[model samples]
Every structure is written in structure tokens, then in C-alpha cells.
Target chain A: MSEIKKDLLYTESHEWLEQQDDGHWRVGITDHAQAQLGELVFVELPGEGDELSQGDACGVVESVKAASDIYAPVGGEVTAINSDLEDSPDLVNTDCYGDGWLFAINVSDESELDELMDADAYTEFVDE
Target chain B: MSEARKTPLYDAHLAAGGQMTEFAGWLLPTRYTELMTEHHAVRRHAGMFDVSHMCIVDITGAEAAAFLRRLLANNIDKLEAPGKALYSCMLNEQGGILDDLIVYWLEADYYRLVVNAATAAKDLHWLQQQSQHFAAGKLQISQRSELALIALQGPEAEAQLLHQLPSLGAQIKALKPFSVLRDDHYCIARTGYTGEDGFEIMLDAAAATTFWQSLLDAGVTPCGLGARDTLRLEAGMSLYGQDMDESVTPLQCGLGWTVAWEPSERAFNGRAALQKQRDDGVAEKVVGLVLDQRNVLRSGYQVFSADDELLGVLTSGTFSPTICKPIGRARVNRNIGNEVMVEIRGKKIPARVVKPVFVRRGQIMPGIET
Candidate 1:
């Protein structure tokens, strides 16, 4: 089945967010989204400290077939970037939910999580 | 015009959970899963493509060979063997390409021609007209639209397809490249479009659905036209409309080598024009370009010199599955320099001009130095 981790939050654009120990939130593409995109060739993620609003274009993902924009799930400042993806983008294809996580962000507003989808809601949204 | 054409294996594609889309006027499978996934599957293992939309035509008569010698751009005298197939272009007298087709020598006076689907009607009309001028009753071109074709391609295609038809196992093994064999029930050709070694099978349209499902049951991954396009593009194979249109001559589209100008006596349509171009030094050559950067270069993109001079236009391009880089074929001025930059979204990306065929047998070619 599609990966819908209960502890995480989701975006309609198919990105997932998990709260880290720090004040930042870990962000990555859900398993369903990665599977739909296929093999990842190149990734263009924002650098650390890049400020972004909710729904802002934070990065880009280019697959062998097409390129897609990675939108910020919630407003935040990119606290950390996944440099591993620069050399091994296929990690996104292999483990989209775990080690393939995109980046971490220090949220500009924690209440924006309310606008994001929870596991159950995201499941229903994707299914529909 | 909105009414979509359906192939015999349409239901099979649906049953396999294929994403359906309209391609070349037919409602066909674009992908069973992700396009890249299916494309990679074909490169690593075996993938089955539903190519029944391709029209197969048969020519037979006392002077069939003679008629084809004049009807096609390539000489047919070389295909003396029964199982041999020859790739040739059907061109108008004005040197415009009508269609590039594969002709199989089935008998002394019989030949099988496979033409692209989009140009099937126009090809048929052209062939009919040519038949009348080149000793009418002595040649006959019959459009066999009732047959269905399935292209099983990739490394393991032969073994997988053999399990489906045990009787043709030995025949498949001995089949050479660009050759075909006709058994009691089917015509199996060792030809494919994916740059992999495989066979294209033709059978009764009614039997197509069952045969397609049987292949799937044999663990043959079902692919669609989307994968087919990327696969062919990577293989450096030309698409009829994109790479070489009616306005192009074989010499300019990297197909001049396929033109047989031997014997100095074989008279074919467009030969004079082609000879003139060849003698006058062809103005352009189709070259392969590998983008040095991450951005994908697409067709209609402007290819320019580093000095900002326009060199050519990209014809077909895609992110190569094997190479993991952007590659495209462009027709550029022969006088232009080797290294050129592609204008992608207003920025110039450096590209290297190298040999046309980029990937072969699941391996990306090396030494494409700028």
C-alpha cells in the first residue's frame, strides 16, 4: 500500500514532513509520490538558510521522464539540505520515506501544520 | 477526429493496469507503471510492446523485386535470401520521404513491408500509384491491416517469448538480425525498435489478445508507447515525423548510409536528387548531442555555436536511461563546428557533438568528448 506514516504530515504536492529533535522539521517525498515519479536522475534542492513561504518552490526533481517542482509544504527557512542527493539521487527511488528524505527546515510558523494533511486525511486525499 | 483508435491488446493493457493515453491517433498504453520504470525494465530485462498499430503490407507478383527496386530508395537486389529484411525509404519523385519501411524477402517474388502507422494511408496511396507505373500487373502491394504485431524486446525477450511458443524455439535461436520466418500460424521477425535484440511477431488480429496475455503470464513486462519513444530515442533510432520529414532527404537525416547506390545501374525514385545532393556535398548532417549540464534539451530547441551563431535545431531528445544524462539528435549545418551550445530557457548549455547512436545493449557509450 501507499506509505502513509501516521506521525508525519503531508502536502497535496506529495511531500511529507516529520518533526526533528531540533526546532526544524524533516521534509521528503512520500513513497507514493516517488513511485509515481520513477527513477530520479537529478535533484535541485535549496541551500541551507534559504527562506521560503508555504507553497514556495524550494527545489526541483528531474526524473528520466519529466521534471517536477518541489514545493515547500509549510513556510520555513531551510535549516539543512540533503547533500547526499546531489550524488546519489537514486536514493529517492530506493527509500523515499527514510534515508531518501529531502531537507530539514526551521518553521517560520508551526500553525501552518494545521493546513497540512495528517496520515488519515492524506490517505483519503490520495485515494480520491 | 476525437474518436480514438484501439488496438487488439487494448483490454490486455487495461487488465495490466496500464495508464492509457492517445498516441498517433490510437488509444494505447503509455505506461503500466511509471514511464521511466518501464523504460528501465526494458533495458535490464524484457519488456513487451503492443505495436499492432504498425501496418504490415505484402507485395507479390512476377516482377515484385523489379518494382521494389524502382519503388524504394534502397536497392532490393541485396535481399536475395528468403528470410532477409532490408530497411529502405519510400520517397516521392521530388526526393521527399514518404515512409521508411522494412521490407522482408519472404519468397522469390513476395516481400513483406512494415510501415509506420501515422503514414500508413499516405504510404498505401503512394505505393498503389507507383505500382501502376512500374509494370502494373507485375507488381502488387497489399495492405495487410488485419494482422496484429507485438514487439518483445530487451535482453531476456527471446527466452520469455520462447516459452510462449515452444515450437518456434529453435527458429528463434537461428534468426539473424533483420530477418523473419513464417510458420504455419505466425510470422516472427528478429527486429525491434528498442535497440535490443528481440522479435516482432505478426499473427491474426483475433489471436493477438490471447497471445499478448500469455506473454504477460510468462513474466514479460508490458511496456507502452511512452517507453518505446524514450527507448528508441536512446538507441538513436529516428522517428518518421520528428527526425526525417517529407522535406528531408536521406543524406541529411543520417540515413544516407542506408541508401544503396551500388551497381551504378539500379534506378530508384529520388536517386537522381540524392546523387545530386551527395555530389554537391550535403549541406547538413544529423549529429548526436550530449548536454554537459543537468537541464534536459528538448526538440525545437535552438542549437548554437559558442560564438553565439545558430548551428542547428534539435530534432529529438530525452534523458537517457542508460547514460543518466540529457541527449538529443540534431540536424546541423555541416559547416558548423563540432561543439555547440543548446539554448534552454534563454540560457546556453554546452553540448558535445559525437556519434549518433548513444546507447547500445544497455550500455552508454563513452568518449563523447567536447
Candidate 2:
């Protein structure tokens, strides 16, 4: 079974949202998502300052077998992108929830976090 | 859903934590460990592959050679010596490739053929139908479903094989490439798809599991289809369905050398069509592509001229683990220049046209920049 952190909130599409220090949010794919994708070879990141809508495709992650789109969980402006992935995309497979964080977003409405699934709910969803 | 067939080593694959996938109607391992790890294992050390899904057929009787000469594009007469093998394609009347196979002359009257699994039934039917013309010679065709195949490949492959079966070291080491040495239970051939020195061993199905375990104990890493694909791609070898099919001829698929046109009186199937195409000139040819960027190239992607005019389509492609770069084979117009564009994900990326061989024998091929 894949690792699921209890402190993070998740979207149905597998992106995990971690609340940031300045009331912003850091987002990255969950461990389950990265495991399903195998070793990642390339990652196309959304540019900083770009506006993203909830449930929209923000970027793509490609492996040797296939390519998949990464979805945004909540609508917001992109505060920062993970520039480290440009050189080492396998970081997503190594430390998915830490240095592999895809991007940070300044949410237009922080209350959208309430609509996302909690760790327990997300784990149950993936199990089924 | 219909059930997929299982090979003799299916359980072994599952025991090794392999990810199972359906390939050509059989449940096979796609990968055991990470893709790059298994790929590098074969390049640096020895790796074993369970290729029992490939079909084996035995042909015997006085007419076997005569029937094959008329049916196959390659001349079977070249296998005059026992245990010699020849790679050839079974072509249709229209000069299209039916399937590519390796035929081994086991003895004066018996020849064995290893064909693709997906096209086994079709190939058998075609062979039977063509044998009618030589009824007086009396040929017998039998499928050897009870046998299993295993391939050991890499620079260290011969040493590993000799270590596991020390008794056969002399004979195995003496066997030349495309040559086979067989006892009652095992047929060991110095033949492999990977552009590395290796042996393809065929044995009774009952001995497969035990043999696989012994090889693993002898330090041969078990590889799956993922590594096999990347290795063959890097070696510039062609995959049957991906690189060529019923609609494509060998002349266009970079296999023109496999066709033998000697003894002008000997007429083979598709000879007329191939001769016509040769006279008229082939319009499109398959060539290798190397991406200038880090993006991965995949099959069915469009290839374009430098000025954005569509040139052709990518036939087979992958991120080459051995070369640590993206490489692919594409069928483009004959007049295409050295510099071309590949449309990946709606963006045209610049690429260079070079020989398909990115690596061979654990060394990078000449003219391919690392």
C-alpha cells in the first residue's frame, strides 16, 4: 500500500494541499499518484503568477510508459513553481510531499480547503 | 473480460514483485524493479528474460527446405550446416511482411522456426497452405508448445551462462552467433534481439522454473518487458507490430538487407511485388531520430520538415536508458533532410536524424553524442 500522510488534505484527483506559514498553500501530487506513475522522467510546471482554476489541468508528468496531467485542487494564483524538477524529476518519486512540492498558490478563498477531503477520507477513497 | 494466457514463469514473476501487464494476449511482467535499474543491469551485467510466449514450430521431411525457399523472403539454403540459423520474413503476395522469424536448420531433414506469438496461428496457416505446391516432398509441420524460451543477455552473459551450466561451457563458448547446439532436452543458441553477446535457450516447459531459479542464483538479474523494449530500441532493433506490419514492406522498414535475391530462377512469394517496388524506387524510409530537448518521444507522433511541413510518423520510440536520451525510429520521406521537427504535445521540437543505433555492447555507437 502507498503511504498517505494524515496531516495533509487531498483532492479526489490526488493532489495534496498543505497549508503554508503565510496563509498560502503548497500543492503536490500524493504518494499514491506518484507510485502509480512509476519513475518520472519529465515534469512540466505551471509558470509563476499564472492563475489556475479548481479542477483544471495545471501541468503534465511523463514516465517511460505514459504521460499524465496534473490537476489543480483549488482556484488561485501561482505563487511559485518547483524549479528543482527541471533537472531531477525523480524527486517526485523520492520525496513526493517534501522537496517535490509542485507549486505554491495564493488562494482567492481559503475556505475552499473545507471542501477538500481530509486524510482519513482520502485514504478511504483511494482504498476503494 | 477474456482471460490472458500465462507463461511457465508467471508465478516467478509475481514472486519477484513484478508489475503484470497484458502483452500480445499473455500476462507478462512489465517491470520488476525500476525501469532504469533493470535496463542498466543488462547493459552492465547479465539479465534474463522469459520469452516463452514466442512460438516454436518444427518442420521436417524432404520438402522442408524447398517449401521454405518458396515461402520465405530470405534464402533458407544458406543454412547448409546443421544448427545454423537464418533470420527472415514471411511475406504475403503483395510484398507486405506477414511476420519476421528465425529458422534454424537442426539437421538435414529438420528445421525449427521461432515466430512471434501474436502471429503464430497465422504463420502456421500460411505455411501449411504454401506447402501444397510441393506435395511430393511431404513436409510435416508441428507446433512445440511444450517448450519454453529464456534469453540471457549483456557483456557478461556468456560468463554467467557458463557459470550456471559449467558442463556445457566448451560447446556454448564455441557456438558462433546465429548458431545452435542442442541436446535432447535443451537447444542453446547464440542469438538475441539485444545488440549484445547472449544466448537464447529453449528447453522443456517442465524445466523452466528450475532453470530460471538457477540463473537467478548465478547472479542474472530478471528483466521484464520494459527493459527489453528500451534495450532493443537503443540497439536499433525493430519491433514487429510497431516498426512494420502487413501494410509495410521490408524495403521501407530498414530491413532490405534481410531479403535475398539470388538464383534468378528461384521465385518466392511477394517476389514480383518487391521487384516492382525496387525498380520504382521506395518513396519512404525508416530513420532514427534524436531529440535535442529532454522531452520523451513516443510512437504515432508526427515528424515534420524544418519548415513545418509534415514528413512522416514515428514508428517506435522511447527514452533510451542506455544512452540517457530520447530516441525513436520514424518512417519519413526519402528526401527528408538531416534536421527535422517532431510534434510532441502540440509543439514542434527540433531533432537530429541519425543512425538508429544509440548503443551496442555497452558502448555508445559512433556519431551519436552522449
lDDT of 1 by residue, A21-65 (tens): 886899999888887777777887888989999999878887766
* Residues B86-174 of candidate 1: C-alpha lDDT, one tens digit per residue: 88888877678888999999988999999998899888888888787767777888888789999999999889877888888898888
Docking class of 1: acceptable
**Candidate 2, position A29, lDDT:** 91
RMSD of 2: 1.5
lDDT of 1 at B262: 92
Stretches > 4 Å off in candidate 1? A4-32, A47-58, A71-79, A94-98, A103-128, B33-45, B132-138, B160-163, B263-267, B291-297, B335-338, B345-347, B362-370
lDDT of 2 by residue, B283-365 (tens): 98988999866778899999999788999999998887766678999999999889999998788998899987888889988
Candidate 2 accuracy as TM-score: 0.97
Whole-model Cα lDDT of every candidate shown, in order: 0.86, 0.90
Candidate whose lDDT is highest = 2
Total colliding residue pairs, candidate 2: 0
Worst 10 residues of 1 chain B by lDDT: B361-370
The superposed Cα distance between candidate 1 and the true structure at residue B306, in angstroms, equals: 2.9
